[model samples]
Target: MSHPQIRHELSKIETNLRIEIGQLAERKQIGIDSQGTNLCELIALLTNAALSDHPLFSQLTKLDAAFCQLDIGLYGLCSDCESEIEPERLILDPVEQRCALCAESYAHEHRHELRLTH
Candidate 1:
């Protein structure tokens, strides 16, 4: 994709993520009490936990760093191999830092490390 398109998409993603995160923060502060039953309370607690550790939160954090890279004109390059990432992949996830091959390789290595540790 062109630089302008990438910037536009990233800007939109950044804005949406910020808005969602702010809403989540507000909900967290107010607490998610159902005040119905024990099951309801448990469900609320679990939902809060899930949202707190949600992958979207991590993506937002990564996107913040990605924006810095975008400012430097380096956003689309793989962080591991420094190759140009696939445009389709970027459209799917603007926060992605590595190409598919590199990401697969890293995941494989990570799994191996986890196995060894276990």
Candidate 2:
């Protein structure tokens, strides 16, 4: 994706994350920042509170990482090959850090690990 598109996409992701956090915080009576909260720490707190119906913690972590990568001007680059990630893949999940080639390779390399976790 181009830089402008990526910035727009990240904005949307941020909005969604904020909405989810707001709803979850309201329901749990937890305090959250209006902007710039630490995603991992906030989620950890929510997890400790035993929130149900929340997004998976790992998913939010990926999103938080995406925002950080964008801040560093590396949002659309693959973590492995450093190539630009396919635009379609980014649409499906803006948090993806691997391009198609590396994703397949990584999947093969980590298949056993995934199975164990699952």
Overall lDDT per candidate, in order of appearance: 0.70, 0.77
lDDT of 2 by residue, 1-118 (tens): 6777877887787778777777767876877652566676766665776763456455666777888898898888899999999989988988998999999999898897878898
Give candidate 2's error at residue 85 in angstroms. Answer: 1.2
Error of 2 at 50 (Å): 7.3
Decoy 1 TM-score against native: 0.67
Distance from true position, residue 59, model 2, in Å?
2.5
lDDT of 1: 0.70
Runs of candidate 2 exceeding 4 Å displacement: 1-4, 22-55, 114-118
Residue 84 shift from truth in candidate 2, angstroms: 2.0
* Per-residue lDDT of candidate 1, residues 1-118 (tens digit): 7777777887787667655655665676744332322333333453556763665556655676677788898998998999999988888888889999999999999899999998
Error of 2 at 43 (Å): 4.7
Score candidate 2 by lDDT.
0.77
**Strongest candidate by TM-score:** 1
lDDT of 1 at 77: 90
